[model samples]
Target chain A: MANDVFAKSLLTRRQALALGASAALAGALPRGALAADEKVTLWHGWTGADNTTALNGVIDTFNKGGKGVTVEPTGYDWDTLFSKWVVSSAGGRAPDLVLFHITELPEFATRKVIRPIDDVVASSGLDLSQVPDAGRTGVTFDGKVYAAPLDVHPLGFYYNVDMVQEAGLDPAKPPKTGEEFLEWAKKLTVKDASGKVTRYGFELPNTWATARWIWFSLMYQNGGTFLDDKGLAAVDSEASQKALQYLVDLINVHGVTNPEVGGNKGEDAFASKQVAMKFIGPWEVNLRMAQKMNFMTAQLPVFGAKPAVWANSHCMAVSKQPNEDKLAADGTFMKWFFDNFAAPATTVGIIPQSKAVRENAAFTGTEQYKYFKSFVDDLPNIVYEPLIPQYLSVFSFDKPTPLVTNLQAALSGSKPVPDALKAMKEGLDAQLKKG
Target chain B: MTSVASQPAGRSKARRASAQEGGAVRSGMTLAAYLFLSPYLALFIAFMLLPTLAAVGISFMRWDILGTPEFIGLDNYRQIFADPLFLTAIKNTFYFVFLTAIPMVVLGLALAMLLDQKLKGTAFVRTVVFLPYVVMVSTVGILWGWLFDKGTGLVNYYLTAIGIEPIAWLKDPHWSMPALAITTVWWTVNTNMIIFLAALQDISEELHDAATLDGAGPWQRFVYITLPLLRPAMALVTALTIINGWRVFGQAYVMTQGGPEASTFVIVQYIYLTAFQNFEMGPAAAAGVVLLLITLVFSLAQMKLMKAI
Candidate 1:
């Protein structure tokens, strides 16, 4: 087996072109035989300071677990990672372990690039008691676990305490309704004499991620589903349109926030204090909450319905190896890493998958940790982004998502809410039909 | 031709052994020739040629990345024409080509002419203008994004200084195409200008002097002699720009993101999103085949019109 593994590596360098072609074919096929000691190569889209922190955190735990395995790590940016992953998968040289966006997993799993982990999980007997049930369902595909949950990073509403106070609102207990929030946003929103905005109430993003986040939170709160059980675009209903219209009103008619707020990133605007309040992922907890500026955290504000927040989980999956022994070892490494290592590190800004780590004493004492822990129970209540293979296409190109087309119309008052929703529905239907 | 070919009996034999001196002769294959050509030919076949062939095959089938490709002859192409988005992509691509290519060639030629004269530090001036061409696409896109950023952008700042209201260059559908055109031209003109400059220099000074003596004005000489001679370069640059303009992805990816109401969406960005983002490689491949055919025909037409072939 060792000789076979050695030969595989040697052959890989000698015939790069042939290997690439063969690998692409093999990637989509059933698992082949294994080498005795499999070295699982893990590629992640984490880099820079955060990437270093994540890499060191995972590597330390994996190495210390004493599983008699080796894991090689490579990191690139998000888009590049996807592009490389696809090309590599087609070429048959993909990594053993990969960390992809939760939204992207459905398509990748369908393509059979990553394997199901049900057998590995059941054999390893990893406890699932502490992990959120919502997160588990998010990574599960076709009734099998193809990925292990690392953490759920939900958007936390970070507010400037100074602005909140000046607006006659309690920083401890934020607005409970859309009207109250709007009132406070208006009061906190500062403008110069000529009506040029000196400070914005909220910085909206004209990108898919932001628009989807806002639209989902509101629609869920207003009792709407983005897609029906049949996987059709269902956001054109009255409730959904109303929710979308409210966001449009905030920009065009309400006059509370800058109409051009979606021009740049909302989080940056909030961090720079150009905006008083903004919805941002929990990853920013370390960056903003630790700052000297007086700030407070709250659940995403309620509009019409119950309190529901948007959430996505980061997942760890073993990359498929050519040899069978290596596959088993890769599985063992995956089980060991998820069971032991990934959970604790995730608590810093992420909710861990290990049921044991959820209420661990390590997380119980910190103030921010306590705030984050409160939402752990809300995991089941949290919504997942679209899990379809064509999900990214829908966001990036399908014109229905306000991030691409309706945003300018919404901002410029060229297209009304109904027209935008209609456009979105038509575009989404076409894409879904194409599938 | 026959006499030239007849002189190399011994030379052809040795050249056959060395693989250096024969045009039509089967030379003894040199180890170096094989060594140099092997890697490129292998890569070309594996990456470029095979994929191109595969794309043609895939275009006839119905497949997404996840599932096996089921053959459905011409169905993908038929569906492509039926799909409104693909049609829109075609229109948007042509719109982008016209918006970018025309201004690029005209501005590039004008700039070449302006800098063609005797001037102090002409080399320095040429380098400065062409610098943007060498910068990474991401950097160029991000810089333009910042410069065109609504409210706070330098462009807006200057416009407002003159009492004109700020324009949301990337956020308005009416304005997005124009904004993208301006940016595309700014990043690409330097290369074309350099090419035009070289072509301009190749024009005989004696001809210009003769035309001047005949009392032909600057525009007349340019129209009669310079423009006619520059056609080959112009044709080449225009064809290249058409291809490049159709593949405008990075700018859209970075700046408007095919946004401001799908005003800046181009074919390549659509193809990328379709394949990688959608995991629909079949459609993406089909889109590429369509683009390849269009570009080939257009390029052929260009060559024919310019009589380059």
Candidate 2:
């Protein structure tokens, strides 16, 4: 019904688009006719205070760059924006540019709603060589570059500095291996006389997909992937099972984590010193800063064989346009964005994907950078979202789905770890069959 | 109950009523009646009927709304029945209704009976009890969520103050549904109270006095007189609460988000996620249609119950 209403609205908007395009050629109506004035509209999900301010700073500079192209950006939270994009693109009228993670490209590109940026990267004057291999690979799908690489935000280990120092552990050095992490957790955990926990060492996020992200990082480190070469379920393999069992043990066997905490509530728990350590993304930097708390972030400890942490990049993608002029104009702005996003992005508290910005003294010299320097150092070791379109159907943030829900089922002790793994395997297999 | 003899009498009566205003104006009045109903009729058709018909039509097809819709017949319905989460959602919804509807009616009547007496501060107490009903569901959800929080919540503070252990009200699967039920009952029970109170007030004081004069006790009088008299109001409250129970979405969504292991996941949330999140429009539509049918059957049964009363 929502799509039907959007489709109905698109009918009028199509005629409006036609009228606007021709009118631009006719004469200048405010922002239309400058002979070469390229107008690009952007839809993004950066409504956070720091991110939005940083974004606005970037846009204001670009709009005033005298490039003969004026850019307009609209902000919504990702969930609503994605739904709107699905409906609008189906009606053959999507935004000129969309800002999202590369993982979302499959959901759009499989239906040809979005276009490849391969043709535009050089055309838009972006230095593709400056972007890292992981950055570029994460954006590629079906042998085509789907989006311009942006910043990488990996799952970070946040801990209370005061609490860690008081626990007789060096604040400068954090845990680096699974065994060390467990030892540190046990050392940091505080309990009362009657066997009640006064402060938890870790917060096991049983309600949201952050814990799932941690599990994914484990799978990657343990040499597992979502599927095998023939596109079959490899998620229930020993690599994956062994990885999740460690986190499960933290809840059931070790009793170090606060099992009752939801996904985002751990931040509050961290602020109040109820929990000493939590694994989440680098976006948490701004939150703790606002609270003026003594906290710092480090790279997630290796839970498996090699070093890997769940990470993804926020990118700029172009929608399929009806005319070449719109696409070209969008490309022009997108190129400018990749070239200039680095400096402003540092203040936004994300790891720079561009090698040029990251190596600069100005980039690494910020007072805030000290807290997340591990993210900068561990950028290359990060593992991005699994490049499957229907993957979101299996696991989603904050919502109940097969994978996230079952993982929580295990963590909550409602189901055995192996049985939960089997349920997720079956769920993924069923979704793959549907596709 | 109309027989063949009643049909001619009805026609003659309508004719006489129309004829008293004279022949010239009768046709115009009928035309005016249609003119008056046109706006509402047009809105109902445009806003309600067409969308409903389109939903049912779409239920039979597998449309992602991005590509062409394929005619899949009853595959979506089959999938919904086979989906284990749908069964859980249905069971959770029923749990919510049972925990809410009957308890709300009984508690509402109990409060109404207390308020019906002309005690001092009756108006103040009535206003206090009814204040939460006017507050929004989302606000109530957030407020109650804080109250029910396991750590620093007022609920836990009081629970442990007198030597009771604090329960994880929203995080435990066993307690999430009851917590939502408590929030819902506190939010909307005043509607049931008002309905029962109106029925109680409509009962004349003379009847109770007569019962007392006839040597009947207050409890006996309530059983023999007030209880039977409140039957129609009870039917209305029961039907309304049941319908509202089946439609419970906002509280569970705002507070628990159908969590503590999806124990509070309701059918509406399932339908929503199926359509929007997974983009399985056919299955979502099928779930929606199933909900419509379930609600319709219950509504019809309630109507029959009302008529029997």
Candidate with the greatest TM-score versus the true structure: 2
lDDT of 1: 0.73
Question: How well does candidate 1 reproduce the true complex, by DockQ?
Answer: 0.27
Model 2, A252: alpha-carbon shift in Å? 2.5
List, residue by residue over A69-92, the lDDT tens digit for candidate 2.
778888897877887888888887
Model 1 agreement with the true structure over B1-309: per-residue lDDT tens digits = 787599679976776666544543434446667878999999999999998999888888776654578988877777668866778778888888878888888999999998898999888999899998888877877787777766557888899899998887776677778888898899899888989999999999999999999999999999999999999899988888878887787877777677666777778877877676666667788899989988888788877877853
Candidate 1 chain A lowest-lDDT run of ten: A29-38
Going through the candidates in order, the fraction of native interface contacts each one reproduces equals: 0.26, 0.33
Chain B fold agreement for model 2, TM-score: 0.84
Q: For residues A91-166, could you state the per-residue lDDT of candidate 1 as single tens digits?
A: 7788778987677788678667888878777776655555677777777889888887877777667779898888
Q: Where does model 2 exceed 4 Å of error?
A: A1-39, A262-267, A342-348, A359-365, B1-41, B111-140, B194-229, B306-309
Predicted chain A of candidate 2: TM-score? 0.89
In terms of docking quality, model 2 is acceptable
